[model samples]
Target: MIQKTLYLLLFFSSFSFSQFDDLDLTPADSLMQEGKIKDAIIEFETNYQKGNRDTNYLYNYACALAEDSQFDKSFAILRESLDLEIKLNPLFDPDFLNLRTDKRWNSFEDELISKIELEYKTIIVDKEYAKKLWKMRALDQAYYFQIHLAERKIGKNTTVVNTLWKVKNNINKENLEKLEKLIQQKGFPKKSLVGNNAVQAAFLIIQHADLQTQKKYVSTIEDLCKKKEADSQSFAYLYDRIEISEGRPQKYGTQVKYNKENQQYELYPLVDKEKVDFWRKEIGLSPINEYLSGYGIKI
Candidate 1:
């Protein structure tokens, strides 16, 4: 119950992302969740063929084919994904376990990541720190979000929080130092100057930082957002989280707290509850009711 709530919260957390951000998955993912594997495979393959070999579509198509027991076809699909320069998940996904016994698995796995590095190498013209920060911040999010799901068969739920925290912390320190200098030398790290991805990376680093750290540049980020340089959605989301963590009410209803006894995540107190939906709409967030449907929330 608590675990399910965590998953729901995680799902809703994406509400804070930019409206223009690429969705990680699609409705076809629900077909897989519903155990209609064949339907999912067909949909994934259709999407892959329709797009310009969108690696996301390609990767999922490969996973679905493997689950359907078509190893040869699956491997072929994965090769297309690699050629598309898809970033591979390091921890082997269970969907590909069946293909792991093949002798070629080791080399294919190595080559997949090598190709991702090659792709990164191509992003060095300008805002190179943006690309570097983007990769680090995204990996940090994955590690933080996957913590609850990491468990052993011994029934003990384990975590890699410390390990992930160390990595995130070091990167955050570097980002903070660079950002402070950037603010003094120029203005805030904005799209015209630092590039869009770097600004996004800056917001991501601040989101995971402690309150005192976030406070140091909250106004600077907000100013950039007003200039239409940084993202307003990200700014509001970070502010809401920081306020909630400090026992203050959230303005956007973007944060929630788990109710252990009820086995759910209830909305955290809001500063102006009636205005939340209005603000959410202005920022392109879905209606709260629609967003909370996964948790069986009505109000």
Candidate 2:
């Protein structure tokens, strides 16, 4: 009887291990790495439905979807992954920037950011209470909030940009000073309140009152971006935006030019026929140019 019981337990354990081993994601990852995006998506979706919806599986699904150009679905899943565990290590994840332009992405990001801000507010309300509870919750929320904010800023999302600006506007001088001091000493800005407001409070430091105040936070953003392997287009877009903001002409593709005199950016064709065809296809302007003409560019 004892021998039979032991055998049964071993069989069950092995069965469990086999189940996980079968969905190890290595094969799907290889497909992704090899740029066989469609195959990877099918593999990942199959396993994800069969296995536990953990961060890794969700991330893989999101990545495969993005690679397959299913931007909306990919963004949704990535946000779901973040929601499961609010904190994530962006240094190791490359899916954030890939979904930047998806309309649904920003609303989800804002919701998460709001939650992070709330968590931060909780800390400020009572330091002792925060010290006890914040660490447990902070890891997920902080990491998520931090990475999301960084990505949005780099992606030049005007809504997020305005939100950060608003946060800075609301912070008082005394709290700002304290937060600055805390950041200098502890490497992260101190929150004056805990809860959803905490992220807003922290944003004050990043936005800063002046260029001198922004120096430290700017360095932090630079460091974070450097640590991650971001998409080339996203990186180039950020680089060009920074240059343009600093009164320099963006030196990228010949398709676009910044006109300092008019304070407007204009798109000029490198190859007139090819560019016209590309624009037409992009905006569905091929069959009817009039409908898209109101979109500010002529194909």
**Model 2 lDDT at residue 205:** 30
Clashing pairs in 1: none
- Per-candidate clashes come to 0, 22
Error of 1 at 46 (Å): 18
**Model 2 lDDT tens row, 174-208:** 44565666656554522333332233334433332
Top-TM-score structure, candidate number: 1
All candidates: TM-score:
0.57, 0.33
Indicate the worst ten consecutive residues by lDDT in candidate 1. 14-23
lDDT of 1 by residue, 71-94 (tens): 888889878876665554422344
* Candidate 2, residue 66: lDDT: 64
Residue 33 miss distance in model 1 (angstroms): 12
lDDT accuracy of residue 122 in candidate 1: 38
Worst 10 residues of 2 by lDDT: 9-18
Taking every candidate in turn, the Cα RMSD to the unseen true structure, in Å, is: 9.4, 20.6
